[model samples]
Target: MSTRNPGSLIARIGASLIVLGSASAFADEVVKIGHAAPLTGANAEWGKDTENGARLAVEEINAKGLVIGGQKVTLELDAQDDASDPRQGTQIAQKLVDDKVVAVVGHMNSGTTIPASKIYSDAGIVEISPSATNPIYTQQGFKTAYRVVATDAQQGPALADYAKKTLGAKSVAIVDDATAYGQGLANEFEKQAKVLGLTVLSHDATNDKAVDFRSILTKVKGEHPDIIMYGGMDATGGPFAKQARQLAIGARVLGGDGLCADSLAKLAGEAADNVVCSIAGMPLEKMPDGPAFEQRYEARFHQHVQLNAPFAYDAVYIIVDAMKRARSVKAADILASMPGADFVGVLGRTQFDAHGDLKQGAISLYDYKGGKQTLLTVVKM
Candidate 1:
């Protein structure tokens, strides 16, 4: 064999040095966990809430000091902004990898979380998504991507039951924003509606930034469905409400947790009222520990509580618990240790399976009656 070129040998050594440098950099730092999400944008509210909850958890965990081996390493919080874009989420994941964070908890939207999971998996980083409810998250066979809340599978079925039993809907039309979460929930709703003895009359799809729903609402109105179940975020559902009213479609509109954000109150105005939906977490008003969280959030950020805020808080705790058990903050170690962890948290008991799916969590249905999210029912599966 010919002798290797001098430049080639230098390149190989440089690459190896870079890798070792990165490892050394991480070893010198305290335990760092990342919170990556759209911290600023239309969906920024969701990201902000998720971040706040995670920050609170990290603070509390470090305060008490998690015993790992013979040392008590203080937890650190590092945040990245994904801007609610899947591509940005991927970049953020890479950034976290470079930082060598022990775990990642963030990117509230499922569309971003789904693709980012691949990055986390490739980097051997454990990711616990607080609010990503897409079924494919776990179905992909990646043990690193974990969710703290129930998936569209449970929420769709629960909402279908509430529509049939509570709304007394004889016929229902389904619509979604064409996102992974939206489309998944819409499809699941159609399936659950059929099983719940409600006739699914029509189906429609919308874009995330679409302002008009006249065409689809018009077609759905023609179907004469008693209800329109919207499997999209409040950003779209708010506009859909106005469009549905304009179309003279008197059907009561229903959406999933994405529509339960407090922003809906201002987005849809009066049209948002009487809209029913199922949310992933108990209302801040319902949980006994909620008021305290709300107060703390208000004090820190000078803002009201965020939807699913408590869920994110609990997600960080679950990760910390795993880290303590694994006696290391490394992602693969935390991932392997997460399964079978019993963590009582802000929402409820938070546990995990080998696939990184939460074992015990409850989904609640909430109605924006008047101007507030009122807890309607709770479902645990």
Candidate 2:
């Protein structure tokens, strides 16, 4: 048995094909962008939505005969599916490295994105995540790792504050699915909960494969807290919500954007009504170009777009815009151009800081009430 480095796997994935497409036409000039997410398995919806946003950006940019460095060029997407796994993320990252993607927009789950980022940074690939909000995504001093949305440090605490002050939660027990994204957020939320004067009762963990939460929930329920703050992607969050209800745990289930989506309504059924989660990006219907994106999405896929689709959309445009500004599709050109760049995007005007974090943190809180994802509050942190 042998293991392959991510840089080695980069040669065979879509990254290579996409980079090759631009290279063959450019006499060595090419602008290659890479994307990775869970396009299959339990959380496929989120992966596809991100793919749609990136694909739409590519289609629109190519249609215009993208002009960069006085050379007519094509923008290519080197996409792969990490399937929401950190190990698979390394595999996809190797593919992107081989393809030499100038910029990237993916690995939607923060747990995976945070680690895959080291690969991209080592390769000097500029990556701007459309959704991964874990604080460490940019905190590791990776100047090339950017996020269009705010970090969980901002999003998780906002929800925690609301839960304590608005919901009047006195005792709160935190639970996470033990993912980098989930635990990272739970860590922050618990810290913030204490700062906000909420009593910390207990903490629990769950993973993607988890189906039985009886033991943990029983202990959390014993705390008799007013709320259960969960930190995990939606694949498990929805089921946890439904299960918590069945177990007669009456506390409100609070979570970050990972649990905020329309499908949760279907998964959680009656439990969905009162479940609240923090959200990144504006609701799909409310973005500047959202209505049109929604209509085209429904026609093309016969499904509604989810929470972070707009952020993904903006991520692609930023990469393409960098190409146009550099006037060269070369990876080096894109990386040099992405930092400190400002652009108008779906979430509003956005700029990247030196470390690749958003210059001004932008995120919103959404509640899954009455079977729809509704915006409760938009915040800048």
lDDT against true structure, model 2: 0.82
Candidates' lDDT values, in order?
A: 0.82, 0.82
User: Looking at model 1, which ten-residue stretch has the lowest summed lDDT?
Assistant: 22-31
Tens digits of lDDT, candidate 1, 1-381: 878799999999999999999877555237899998788878888888778888887887777767676655778889889987888888898998899898889768898899999988888788888889988888898878888888898888888888888778889988999998899999888898898788887787888989888888878988998889998888888888877877778888888889987788788777777588887656666665778878877887787776867877878888878877888767778878877588875666677776677676567877777777677778877
Which RMSD values do the candidates have, in order?
A: 8.5, 10.1
Q: Kindly state the number of residue pairs that clash in model 1.
A: 0
Q: What's each prediction's clash count?
A: 0, 9
List pairs with backbone clashes in candidate 1.
none
**How far off is residue 336 in model 2, in Å?**
1.3
Supply candidate 2's per-residue lDDT for 249. Answer: 91
For model 2, residues 267-338, the per-residue Cα lDDT tens digits are 788888768888765556556677877776667667777766678778888887787787767767788888
